[model samples]
Target chain A: MDINILLVDDEADFVETMVKRFGIRKMPIDSAKSGQEALTSLAAKDYDVIILDVRMPGMDGLETLKLIRARAPLTEVIMLTGHASLEAGMQGMNMGAYDYVLKPADFDDLLDKVRKAFERKQLNAKARKQGA
Target chain B: MPRPANRAPEPASDPHGDPKGILARATGARLWKDHSLLLWAHFLVPPVLAALVVAATFATPILAGILAAIVLGIAAVSARGLLSRLSQTEEARLALNTQLIQSQKLAAIGELSAGIAHEINNPIAIIAQEAEWAAHLIGEAEKGCSADFAEVKDSLREVRAQVDRCKNITHKLLDFARKREPVLQDVDVVRIIEDMARLVDKEASYKNVTLVRSLPQDLPKLRTDAPLLRQVVLNLMTNALHAVDTGGRIEVSALADDEALEICIKDNGCGIAPENIDKIFNPFFTTKPPGQGTGLGLSMCHTLVDGMKGKISVASKPGQGAAFTVRLPRRV
Candidate 1:
């Protein structure tokens, strides 16, 4: 599946490392430092999956998810929580999120989830098209 | 607040180093203690006098009786006022002491965890980066070289995995040390478990571990912090995975009655030692080797469960594996 991804987090070093690693894998990736920046990027481009940090400074991951669902219903959202609280993940899922992943996650594991989420989104789009 | 002009001059050096200031402060403290004791005795005297006057009224004349009545009335009012004020001050002092102790514990935990994270994570990050760089360079060189690089590649992979493991422990250490305000909500326990299982199922399979989940279909929804509860369960489940060898069985079962909902994670792995069982939940106390665990997982789990007004306990015997049970109040 062709997936365009956006990573939103306040941790610059983590983001840089992830972006470079994913770049080596030839995955299409973009990043933002804050929720506001994430929203701006979301408006500027169409991404299949948005990996959002739950503990950002302003407009946290949940709030950003709300705007994403409102603006682009077809776009899937994956929450990333640094701490091991599944509550944040569940909250995100309840708020119409695609899924959630823990931080410091294995890259292969994360990539597998991202691919599955993108495929799910693509299937939904195809269904909508067929219905129309 | 400025010191009085007649008061002794402030010490220019440490109290221990300045003999005169130390002596003066000690004397002043002792005098203040004596004064407070006298004041407390003064408050107690009125109540005693009131009781004595009431007892003596039976042996006195009519005029003396009237005088005793007035004295008793004034004493009663003063005694009541003093006792209430004294109790209030005592309560305030107790509360301040409790708060002081709590803050001290939190401060110490914060400092220790921060120190561990800083001291360990920086080195871990560098090691991981250097390993990745070396692997990259080796990959490039392998394109032209005819010699076997299989062992070199396998060693580099092992190094990277160890670095990642160190990173995970440091991250968990910071998680345990940092205080969090859990946002509570009405939660479906079943859903939370499913989510946690989804996250761990891959690893369970990779380890050849069998995960058996048993929950009643009629289980009621729980009213508590979902994330905290999920964390506690996940930690227990992960610990169970580690305790058992490949092909071992781990059962996660949930049951609820009238009082509380209980979730148990039981594994048929190498059971905890008799001496180590009691210390399992203590921070930095691990049975695992040095590089394998930071020993923060169970402690953090304990903290999270306690924060939710829940209880966590364990039962185990050598050669019988272990069982961790978490009890959460069933509000809804």
Candidate 2:
């Protein structure tokens, strides 16, 4: 698979490292510094999965998630947060994020979740097609 | 799995058997297994004793009378036993019927509330927007007016806040009512639980509560809807955190068997009262004072677990603590 992935975070260093890590795996990933920018990117291209940082400067992850879901209902979102805030995690999952991973997440674990999320998107798409 | 619409109908092996006939056969098999001896005695003993009674009547009246009395006594005893057994079965069926009716009522109420929530949401949104617009107009007028409109702005802010509160309740109601089909995927059960537990770690620490995880290392991966499971675990953990007092303890554990995977959240806190236990999972059922809780968390958990073809239950003793268990099938 050719998976279209987007990484949204405000931290420059975190975004840079993720881009490089995914690049080494032969998977080119898009990056966004804020939720607004993520929405812009989403409008331009259809993405299968999104790795979103919870705490951001402009639009928070949960708010961004609501919009992303509205814009692209099939896209899967995985929330990443630096701090373990119980409230945000609850809200994120309730709002339809695929999974929630804390900062310092194991690279392999994150990759596994991403793959699973992509698989769900494919299944959902196929299901919708059949339903239609 | 293949779509139901595309699948072929199953073949019935018996050419003469329709669906009803197959059902009757199944019931008959079960009845035979359970009461075969009773049936044999009931059919055979009566005829055999009647023949002996007739023979005795032909020979002597006294012996025939004795035999007839014995037969009558046995029949009376068996009739009494069967009557008691039938009454017991009737009582059990009545209880089950009540339960079924209660659940059906709950489902109907759930649907009605969801419809009300949906119909109310738009007006709530409009109210919030009008509040905002009114505040803006007041702000624009305040600039040109000589008098202070401070109190008016304050009231507008209050209206907006109250509107937001209504919005929150309606949104939760909508969530409770939404029919989300579970999307199955390969899920690492341990990883998902650990991730959600980490989210609760900081809050747990603040309350001096220890969140112990006893997840087994050999637990199997589950095929389930990942986010729905995540929501259930997170809500339950959060509920536990609220239940515990300072320096309290909460334990999160996961167990897997061949058939199902079980995750439990146990808390040492004020347990539910016996009177309130049955009402806990009902929507809008809350023990917390007004404005403290919306009471949708556990009910939402119930709804989500049901969507995933799983079961959720609670066991609690007042003054001791409470434990909630969520059991998911190995494959949904």
- The top-ranked prediction according to TM-score is 2
What shift in Å separates residue B125 of candidate 1 from its native position after superposition?
A: 8.7
Position B249, candidate 2: lDDT: 95
TM-scores of all candidate predictions against the true structure: 0.46, 0.85
Local distance difference test, each candidate:
0.74, 0.85
The residue-by-residue lDDT of candidate 2 on B1-332, one tens digit each, is 22223222223232223533444343333333476798678667766787888999999999999998888777777778667666665565565455445445556656666777777878888998898999899889988979899999999899988989988888777765777777888788898888888899999999999999999988988999989999999999999999999999999999988889999999999999999887788888888899999888998898788778787889999988899999988855
Worst 10 residues of 1 chain B by lDDT: B1-10
lDDT of 2 at B255: 97
Model 2 regions lying over 4 Å from their true place: B1-46, B49-95
Candidate 1 error regions (>4 Å): A1-132, B1-111, B115-170
Judge candidate 2 at residue B151 and give its lDDT.
98
For model 2, what is the alpha-carbon lDDT of residue B91?
A: 62
TM-score for model 1? 0.46
* Candidate 1 DockQ, CA atoms: 0.05
Chain A TM-score values, per prediction: 0.95, 0.99
DockQ of predictions, in order shown: 0.05, 0.87
